[model samples]
Target: MSEATHTTEILIVGAGPSGLALAVDLARRGARTLVVDRAAALFPGSRGKGMQPRTLEVLDDLGVLDAVRAAGGPAPVGMVWSEGSRQGELRMFDVSEPTEAEPYQGLWLIPQWRTQQILLARLRELGGDVTFDRELTGLAQDADGVTASFATGPEVRARYAVAADGGRSTVRRLLGIGMTGETVDPSPTLVADVRVPALDRDNWHLFPPAGETGFMAICPLPGTEDFQLTANFPDPDTVVDLSPDGIRKAVTARSHLAPEDVTEVRWASDFRPRAALADRFREGRVFLAGDAAHVHSPAGGQGLNTSVQDAYNLGWKLGAVLRGDADEALLDTYEEERRPVAAAMLGLSTRVHRGEERRGRATQQLGLGYRDSALCVDTRDSIPPDALHAGDRAPDGHRGGVRLFDTFRGPHWTLLTVGTAPATDLPPLKNVRPAHIPPYEAYGTGVFLVRPDGYVGWAGETPTGLTDYAAAAGLA
Candidate 1:
């Protein structure tokens, strides 16, 4: 490796959803960022294909939602088959409609490859790009910054570094962070992307376990002439064949379709479902996000969504501290607020994988929040339990002439006054957007200080403690 050194404000150690999302966020804020991926190119498989409602909102704020929506469609209804005969349709999830508070009420289906492409495009539009083929070999951090050495390139020194490098992360290993949890399912499962011109795209074809074989499903991928096939094996130690013929045989044996119907196998992999969380999210100047911090079963489609939200939670804080606008302590909240959320989502995914839970509102992630975090400051004493409070997701709606989401779309904190205005003097702060609207039931009567990640960081009947809260939150 070359002995030369390169520097950036932030070094992101993956180009997946989490790293790419963080790159986009930091780029938009004019923070110098470098995203490095060990892979030669973006991941090509259709893994993590489901986009939860909350992720759609995050993509929107990243300025790639239009492209994402145009490139994807809603998940199809499940069509079961048995003994070479078609069965009735099965609803995979409880259907929901868009509400004022939750504009994206249902799941969206876009292949993971396509989502990465969209994010890469948006990053380029913002004057940022990822460096491929750069594998992190070692990492060292001090009180001032982090230095990451690569296998084939010059070492990178950054003010901070984040590991979004998947479940078996090199960064996490280098930091000696241990993951704790259990194997959700011991049965090895095969997931592949294939082309089947004979398959209908309207429904996700499902085949129940027959005799000694396990279950299988073939779902058509939207905006492409491909389908994603998944099959389970009864034995945990069984070796999965990833060849085209193997995939064809797996489909032929499990489903009503013939091996010849599977015209092409684009990509394939196999894994046993597991749930694990890192012992800690941060080691000095290095932080872990996405799969590096937590692994899920992928049953409830929470892995990628939770991972992306981790980036959303950390991006603004990194930007704030790097830009000298906030105290470095703000960075500590990234793990504080996200670790519990990851743990809960892990349980949810495991339950869904075991058929003990349904893909409903919980899977949507719209109700997830950080109400109990150290950053949440709820000054009002008589607020109801169900009412919106500090650390709750700020609802999106149109009250008066301002659309709440539209106002919260950028990289800035928003002071939303609902049914009431400030009763005391406000502090001067940069990149903090303030808006006042007439009384709205969703927010009740108060001044809500919304974080850049669209969560209410502080709430009060008036602005008596708003300035102090802002200072403590690294906003003032």
Candidate 2:
């Protein structure tokens, strides 16, 4: 049972959305990464079909937003049916239009499989690839790096390892970390992808429950001929059958469609809705991400979005540290900033599952930030409470013949001066691009130092303490 040995800068333990997104980001930044998945291929299902606005922005930064849009569409209106009669349509989400600051205002419907395909394609385009059928059997880390042993292949040595292997993460278990949470719903749910020849693709079809039955929904997946069928079971102890015949029977019992209406069953699974957060996101050189760090119910569409964001937030920090532009201490901020966010989103998901909240602004995730983080340094005086501060997301707009997001794109930090030039001499910072713009209402008049992840790391009225801050952040 001897093992071959390999080495990489970063070893990602799963090839799902989180791992793929992180690989793409790191590859574009000239970091060497090895992504391995225990499964044989990419996921082939329509689960986690809702993509929030913030996630759309992340895709745009990763250079795959156009492809994602082409592969998917907006959420359709839900049509209600009772006793084989059409009832009034019900809106699944509050409608909101795009604005200058916030371009993506609503949820987009893209199958999780399609999203992973786009990310994988982008990763390969950036010179990265994922090795499938490589199951991690054990991992050990010391003061310098981590060594991961696989079940039947070579061992991998990496400076850092991330566990994106989902809720029952093997890496987390090997690290001896515990999760703290509760079951949001004990009832079982059946979700399946099927081809319904007689169903229309214009609207999401909903069927009200009959006596002693639960609600059912059949949503038409965008850009595909398949429909996603979801049915809730009333009994907590009931076993859900996932076979084709079993799914056909469930549809027949819950809706007006007969058993024969379901032409084919492509994929099916069952789960009890639950929410949980890891006790810690980091352990030595190992880190937890995506479902490995937090688990959410599918009600608010927060689980996948939050998972992708976890990768986005960690990617830049890892790139900076690995490229020698920032100190290793930058990695500590990943857990500090993202843990609270995951906690808040976990609560939001549970609330949405229980029907206590609406799918609106909070679901969009535009208001989430890290103003209280240690990396946020705001030296300006008399700032309004509602105004954008350090650690807030930088707004996108055009001013002085430059698009702010365009300037902020890529793997480098940005120094933006609005309505004022530097009052003092600026330091020579590595990988920090500087620009100037006229007074913009979104940013006001200040000197903003934006991080690679598009958050304001430091803000001041002038360049008085900019050099000192840069030195502290390892940019000098």
Candidate 3:
């Protein structure tokens, strides 16, 4: 290690989607953040390929949704094949049309690498860049800050730290945190990115289990000529091969294509599906995010989406606390809110892996919220069960010539008036944007205090307790 020392407001211990996403959010908020990765470069594999609608909204707020859309298209329909013959078409997700509230519907297909590249670009645009090949070796946290030592670079000290490292998180281990989980599948699976020019790029080709081999799927990766290949091994003890020749041989044996048809193997790996969650998310000044906090089976395409959301949930709170816009107690909500959601998503992933649930609205994650959280304050009578409430996601709409999402964008809380004006003088708060819209059935009628992350933190028929809520939230 070098004798020099580096300091920042926040230290992030991974450059994957979660870390990069959090860095982007923090950068846009003018927070000094440092993101470091053990690997020499961004991830190269095509793992975690599907981006849900909620994530699209997140990217939109991060100012990278257009790039993400240009990099990928919707997931193609599955086409089963046997003996070089085509079978009927099968839909992967329960499709839905875009609505005023939910503009992004269905799953978008893009490789994990492309998504990370988009995030990194946005981070750079915000004057933040990730440091590569800086492997964390030690961590110690005091009441005031955290110190992280690297193997070959200068040690980093920051007021706060986050572990965006993957499932085998060194930071989590350093903190003595234990994860409780189970293997979702006993069989090992192989996934790879390869180029097969002979295979049509329109449909996701699938093959049923034959003589000895399990199922195989080859899906085209949008915006790229490569295809992602997935194969299953029924025997848990089978040692799968990951080399180019091995991938070509597996492709030839499973599908009608010959070994020569698989011209290139970009990347490959194998894993047994598993679901795990950390015993806790925070320990003193450090917090766990992404796969460091939870691991999913990837069946419902929930792992990456959930991980990104973990960053989204923590980013604003960290920024608010660091900027002195909120009380230090505001940070407690990170774990209070995200743990239950992670636990529920883990169960959903396991069920989807076992064919018990379909990739539908539940997988979209728009309904996930903090309704039962301590931060939620809904002081209204005769509230309908179906009406949007405090802690629910603030819906998007165009009313009174104003678009709700556009007003909610950025790292600021929004005081939104829907079909009602404040009956009393509104309390002044720092970094809080105000907007008023005509009556919209999605939100009914109320004065909602939207959090920086786009959830309604407080709602009421009028601005009765708004001042107290603002002070408690540390925005006074």
List the global CA lDDT of all models. 0.92, 0.91, 0.92
**TM-scores, each model vs. reference:** 0.98, 0.98, 0.98
- Candidate 2 segments whose C-alpha is farther than 4 A from its true place: 1-3, 422-424
Error of 2 at 256 (Å): 0.6
Q: How would you order the candidates by lDDT, starting with the best?
A: 3, 1, 2
The TM-score, computed over Cα atoms with residue i paired to residue i, of candidate 1 is 0.98
What does the lDDT read for residue 460 in candidate 1? 91
* lDDT tens per residue, model 3, 251-340: 877888999999999999999999999999999999999999999898899989988999999999999898887788888999999999
Clashing pairs in 3: none
Worst 10 residues of 3 by lDDT: 421-430
Candidate 1: C-alpha lDDT: 0.92
Residue 14 miss distance in model 1 (angstroms): 0.9
For model 1, how does the per-residue alpha-carbon lDDT over 98-156 read when each residue is reduced to its tens digit? Answer: 98888997789999999999999999999999999999999988878999998998899
State each candidate's clash count: 0, 0, 0
Q: Which stretches of candidate 3 lie over 4 Å from their true place?
A: 1-3, 422-424
Find the 10 residues in a row with the least total lDDT in model 2: 421-430
